[model samples]
Target: MSPLSPVLDGPLQRSWPWLLAGALIYLSFGFTEMMGSDLWWHIAAGREVIQQGSPWLVDDWSFTEQGSAWHNHEWLADLLFYGWVRVFGVASLVIWKWSLIIATFCLFQQLLTRISGNALAALLACTAAVAIAAPFLDMRPQLYSLLGLAVLLELTLFRSPRLKALLPLFLVWVNLHGGFVFGLMVLAIVLFPWRECSLAALRRAAFTWSACALICLVNPDGLRIFCLPLVYALNADSPYRSLGEWRSPFEAGGITSAWYAYSLVIGAALSLTWLLPAVRRRVRFSPELVAIAVLSAAMSATSRRFIILWAMAFALLLAPFAGALLRQKLVQPLMLPALLALTIWGGLRVAPYSLSSGIAFHYLTAEYVFPHGLADFVEANDLQGKTFAFYNWGGYLHWRSDGALKVFIDGRANTLFDDATYLDYVTVLGARPGWIETVEDSGAELFMWPRGRNGVRLTRGLLQTGRWRLLYEDVRGVLLAREGFALPVTLRLPDDSVDTQLTAAYLASKKGDTVATLAAASRAHEQRPWGRATCTWLRRSLQANGQLREAESVMEACRAYFPSKYLR
Candidate 1:
């Protein structure tokens, strides 16, 4: 057969529109560089498993819970992730993640095409789903969750519902990640209300759901894996709830334009049924569809993280309505023109035009993911033991420290910590009542917090306790030591410059060491002779440290440095 024959008449010829459309979706999403902070710990955990040959029952990266039992359900996904790194290196992990994302969209598009029949509607729905789901597209196990959901729907919902086919899927799903529970829920909803009197279909569906439920027990955790989803769900007070991803889409504020676009697509797609009576009539509403819609919507309303799942539900449930709307008497006239324009747009986006900086390979660089400088300083200083850090920075700390230095918390959240732990974290970070006592109680030796509302407040509390000394301060994060801890002599030395003396004085004041700050600032002023800045800084530092008497002495010294200004 001629090569052109396949393009002209084969399955490839028939599906080229959606094939191209899926390619466009993949390219658009692939262009986004994966730079998740939590990727570090996941990678580290995977490496740990590779080294030890088993998941650690006790915590590996937290000082407070050093020996606490840990349940790493995503071990299989982590193994695959780190396996990619082992085989091809870090750069290949990026490609691996991108390949998974693309494959997910491809499966989703195929499912949509089967339901909608119209390629344009499928493309539009998939585009909106991709846009909404973009935030969750990190190089984490959640990528597997996305792909698994697509495959589950395609197999059970769209194709022949075989009981045996679903068992292996669930077996993999259960081991791959805790998201297997989501698949179980979807399966139950789909099978529970089979109105068809056909006994055989009902038996098959029932057997399929039962088999899925049973196979979930096949994981390493056995029975305990069943309780995990419930534990994760009931963790309402988790400090992770403070993260935007964990908040409800409605309650989540400071949204970008992409969210608005996603909202518009959802609204427009769902409204078609109501606006056009014929479209509503065309839809074959099943019990499964109704259940999924209500459940997915409720889940999405509870947390922004579920919005992607809800988006997929919407695309699957409303594809027929969208397809009907596209074929409407009023819409058909414009469909061809719109399709042509959309096709051109898709082609342009997918084509590698090379006008840009050649696909931004710099996104995965050290400057973005790793805290190399801070890690070096801490390692050099031998700063180990309990280290308090923001959740965002915790993963990087865990990874770079090679499990040697332990953090108080990390991105693992429900996997490693309980609600009480997260509550204590939130309370301490908020600088609320008993915050200083909480910090002291944790027995953490070092505090490293990123620059943020909570981090800044917590840092202030750490400094005010008169029990910590500043070690490193930068825009990215600050590292402080518990008092009585000695720093290297080189780090402790103040430079001769006025600015350096001021910085040193500020740090000393934070430590409540008024005498040291005053002496350092005095020396700097004495050297410069005409250094008004050093004298002013000395006076301020003394006042800040509550040395009123010595503060007056510095003020008097300032008059000597700048008589004209002091006299005024």
Candidate 2:
């Protein structure tokens, strides 16, 4: 089959609404200008590979695990994404990201249409699948996985069963992402005899499955690449426990999109099995769908990161049964069109004010920009000694420091850093016991805390010690150096509405400047009433100003809202 074979060659009358809905869903996600936390390191590694003419074989980004053996499994993917950034810039990559996503959903919708023979069924299924997978969509290696899965499913379900087309698919997939193993697993499941399949069909599937597995070794790392999955599995017990993506979907309390998708998929399965047995009988449950569904469900339950993979399988497996059920139960003419319009409108409302804003060369934002500034200060001051860094900012720091500076940890999680390092990070950031000892033992010369998350606790703890000096502070981040260490520039933070006021409150109390402190703190509190840091600052200011009644009122409000021991 040609490259465009998966795209439907049919008329637009029935397909356009479903396609439009899918496009809207994907665009909503793609419009966000922020890249994934991992994108920075990937691009950095890619740039290294391009310039140095060799792939990174050992860890160099972190201070703790520097020179340790590193697994550059997705080297090819890194090269491709970075190459795109070099050629067309980040804005073009954003467009390219959305294009790939759009193509993936188009192929998926085409596959659903083939299976259900109902446009409305395909539309609803595609919309739900996109919704479930929306959060994971970005300019990352996973985009290739999405596209690859769509093509793989189309070939397995819609096209003739042949091993020839799958060889090249696996060849490309192995280099793109480690998720290729998932595709092989799905194929293995499809090869199993759940339904009446011919001997020739079984032989072809067996050939394709084995060939794909063998082709996975075509990468630079060769056979060692097979161990990537094992590394990821072992991460379950590592620092990944604290990361949101690694958490179980059921562990979260609120109603996230994953919950909705999970409920729908599980509900559809149960309803088909028990409530609508007649529909189940009519709609043949193929071996491929059954295998994909079971495997995807188990994986999704274990890790929320795999929910998109499960969502893809869910959309495909449930479409036929859902179509049959809907056809018999309801008859409405404008329902599909209305759904398309609503999805488009929702996507529009949620899209960034400018689709291309802050999406060139780098995703510059207040959250990420502050770290870059801090890194610049660190470089200018020649403070390349041991440094404690926020976990998420490690990637950006590694990229921005031109390989001259190393971090305590990065987004690699358990893949590189040990569990102890992660525990120390959490302990220090949370102001727990052993935190000061952790910092002292590491021989760290300076610490950089992203202000939004851990800055308040860290800043307060450092102030209590009196051993560290505040060097630089901003709404995005705060930097502290060991006492007696001189900075290249004077210690003066920019006057931002948030961090400036909070910092002023802290500094004023230290200097016994009640009037200035209270004024700054009160303004910050009014600007953001919910922030614990602002509340803490305001309360401290009120107390330092000799306003015991107002300080108690602030404390009461804090207890009412946050109810944390830190406030007490």
TM-score of each: 0.75, 0.77
Clash pairs, model 2 backbone: none
Looking at model 1, the pairs that clash are: none
Please, what is the whole-model Cα lDDT of each candidate in the order they appear? 0.66, 0.68
lDDT of 2 by residue, 1-568 (tens): 4111223333432667667766776666554333356877777778767765876457777778888866777778888878877887644666777688888888898778778666666767876788777766656788888888888887766345467788899888988888888888876775554455788768776776778889888887788777775454445665655567666677773224544456456735643573455744667545566667778777877677677788887787667766665454354455556566757675764453335433222332213234655665565566665678777777777667756667787777765777888888888877788788898787677788876576788777877889998777644677888776555555433435565566667666667788988888898888766455677778877777688898889878755553433444
Cα-based lDDT at residue 194, candidate 2: 46
Clashes of each: 0, 0
Q: Name the runs in model 2 displaced over 4 angstroms.
A: 1-18, 29-35, 91-93, 193-203, 230-236, 253-255, 258-271, 274-277, 325-353, 359-370, 379-383, 463-467, 483-568
Q: In model 2, how large is the Cα lDDT of residue 529?
A: 63
Report the C-alpha lDDT of model 1 over 209-281, residue by residue, as the tens digit: 8878998887768888877754534567655666765765666462222563456366555644555666456
- Candidate 1: regions farther than 4 A off: 1-13, 30-35, 192-195, 198-201, 230-240, 254-283, 325-340, 347-370, 454-466, 484-568
Query: In model 2, how large is the Cα lDDT of residue 208?
Result: 68
